[model samples]
Target: MNIKKENDKEDNENVEVFDEILDKSFIESYDPSIIVENQVTTETNYGDFQHLGCYIICVLIIYEFLLLLLMGNITFLIFGAAVPNVIGCIGENKNYTFTENGCIKLYEIQKNESCIPIIENQFESIQSEYNLYCKEAENVKQTSAFLQMFAMMIGATFGGQLSDNFGRVKTIKYSLFFIIICCFLSSYATTIEVFNIYRFLGSIFVGTKSSVLHVLLLEYLPKQHRVWVSTIFSFSPNYIIFSFMAYYTKNWRDLMFVISFIGLIGLILINFVKEPVRWLIQKGKLSKARQSMIFIEKWSGKLTDNMEKKIFDYIEEESFKQEESQRRKKSYTFKHLFVTWKLTSYSLFFGYSALVGCFINYALIFNLEKVSGSIFMNTAYLGLIRWFFNISVGILDYYVKWFGRKTCHTLAMVTIILTLSIVLLNIYFPLQQQYIVRFATLFAISMCSQIFIANSVAQTELFPTSIRNIAVSFQAVFARLGSIVAPFLFGFQSYSLTLPYLIMVTMSIVDLTTIWILIPETKGDKLKDHLPNKDEWIFGKKNRELKLLKKVELEKKYGSRCN
Candidate 1:
């Protein structure tokens, strides 16, 4: 009995020694308090109740889809659709009867300055001609177009910040309600100034919706599907709603009103979306978080204390694994974002944003006038093509993992450059038999541009969760700025298309170079693990060590009482 007791005491001492070493190493490497808090509150592996809420939220998102459709297409049509038609209307002879074919003829005449206005002595006739001319002037329409683009950018930037500070759900709901108010006001605006104000206000909500919806959808989804869901949320609704918009309204004001009504629907539906569990935890609403988790459990039909315990255990295990890997790493800081290696990633992201914004926005508009038979025909054709492209891309998204993001991006960039080159060459050297070629080139440009969808995945994976929203929004802000500028620069003069295309090509080359130099392979990587090598220690390494130490401490503190 005396010998056995001595052996047992020896074993206990050895275990204590082993634990002490682990504890010290863990504390030196990571912060234990942080790991334990994260493990208890991170809210991963949700039960079915959460998913049910997600489904309800998705239905609300459909209303968002409707609003997004209205906002994007309304701007597209105002600038691309109305400006050209108004220009054609202004140059038409006063006595010339309006006919479908005549509209095309009048447009061509206006393009060449062949149509001259007839002078009349009568005051009424002069007044009538002046009114029509004012209505159709390209300069006036162009200003409106510029305002719409500017509004989109300004709104998005401001909206993104607001959404971050307020709850995502609140930002979405309020912005949507504001959108409805703007739409109604827009419908009643008699002067150009009032119309612009309404449009600008509506644009703010439009911009807010973009980031807010993305964050909400991504947070609501399981981590595995978050990227995919974000992409779908970004692309699919624009295609569907815009296609419907094209089919519905002829008057610009009527279109604006229709869009506002859609925004109201989205606002009403906002009540259905539950605040994400992660957001609740972040806000330190533990009871609400528990209710959300239990709701998910019941809905999934997997409710049990063991299941909750297992989730807790899994989190601890992951925490320890991270700590073990990070034991030897150094810490990272915000300054690391500007260092030599990290700057490459920023440059690559900026280039990608610039290229997509300029090429897609301008190329599509230029192609409509250059390729299709008439302005109306071009609008119809481009809308249809865009619809097809979006649908095809949605399908392609499922298989994008197979091609890999870098390869897919490179392929798309190459395709866009080639197609754009052909269009630019046609512009330089007019061809008698090249109409078909021009049309084919435009279609290719639209198809190739679908690759920008990859931006959501790439940008999201490039930064840690702490800076992900800010980083993504920063890149997006630049992209929106690019979108705002491309139109005024490219579509301003009849001959300005060459300058824009040349600039786009140059941007694409830069994008490709940046992609090659930076942009590490990120396929199948987790969001938390996306930090660059330097950041791996601070955000990555220390996190792991802290977690392991906490786990050991928990066992030490709770083992005797529980056993």
Candidate 2:
């Protein structure tokens, strides 16, 4: 069988020789989806199992550790412990003012008087420690939350640069180290200013490590094994644990310390792992790439001599291709994402979807008080529901061929809109049963979680390896941007109860439009390692017809056996 090119004699010769080499071992050692237009993608089949356990565990622990800190702080402020009533207040004028709840309103205080704050119990929380109560204190709380998310946005950008330039594993390790130190310092903060400072510092690494580690894990796993990402990587179960811990500890400082200690597990586990082979090869570290392959072979105990030889041959070929591609173009950065029209469109579409998804996700959580239920129980329910949906979405993404990434993402948005609309219905036509209202609220938020996994997998698969982390990080930056703004709009409830849900519905519509129009069906597609060229634009209709025709021609010549 001839699998040679006809346009160029030189190319035909190269293809003939390459096909000869692949005939030896490609059928058994690699996924054939990697072959396209004479460009070979190097992927190993053995290392996924070896790398998956440690990768998932390490990411899960560290990711949940950071989220636990964020969620615990929010939960403590929203649903506080028992509050002591003030019996009396001592004035700065040496006069005593008696009042219920132990104090006079700030507005009622005389020019020469000051209200002394009094407390009965030693319940430790940000509000109690910093006296973040009253109308003016709301601004401080908002600012603190804003700063934490702002730091995260900057960290996402910085982390992507570090990952693409230095390597994913190194960036992850350094970020985790800083996170542990800052978390400890934040716990011991003596003042609000000091506490916010340490938290801001820690959040930077939180954003950094989260993006880098996720990209690393995605790179390590094969396309087929990515189902685990949505399930194990959900880490939502940690939410239930966090709720229980917060209830039992009842001290914000203790909670922070606990989360800090948990981060140590991820730090330890990551030390045992190495850089992914894909990342190593992309960066032109052929020697290191080969070493990584050997390491995986040892771990999996499945790389026979023949399989090893085939793997090395593929790696050697990919290395030569990488060198040639690099000579044609320089190293990739975030700017490259927009260099081509196709790249720009994909980047913007996914980035916008991420922003909208995250906004709706946090908005619903912040608005959880509107639902009629215990906050702790509601929080646990959110986690469990999200976990179950994560697994469901993963199975559909991997097994259900027709339910592609675009369809799944579109379904999630539709579900959110429909559920939130039900919540809206309760506003105009109040639901007699409070449980129905509560269910809609929880259901809306839980379904929105699916968007995160769907958008992430689609972005990773569609983007090339050269700028893969940057693409993911670009989306993270947008997601963090949404999170930063969510709290401010969370106050829309004060103006009108229906306003928040209305906003979410509107955003969901916008997200659904993007998915239907811009996003592609990427379920069974190969992961490209080079930047896209003309006629390969994700939204190029003409390109699709050309590809289809080419595929038909090849099928007629090679028969189905080529597949």
Q: Candidate 1 clash total?
A: 10
Model 2, position 9, has a per-residue lDDT of: 76
TM value for model 1: 0.69
192-268 in candidate 2: lDDT tens per residue? 78888987898898888767766776676767767546554664665677767766777778877877776676677
Model 2 RMSD in angstroms: 9.5
Instruction: Give lDDT per model, in order.
Output: 0.55, 0.70
List residue ranges in candidate 1 displaced over 4 A.
Answer: 1-81, 84-136, 223-243, 297-344, 351-355, 366-371, 374-401, 429-449, 491-497, 529-563
Candidate 2 clashes between residue pairs 3 or more apart in a chain or in different chains: 86-101, 86-102
TM-score of each: 0.69, 0.77
TM-score of 2: 0.77
- Top candidate by TM-score: 2
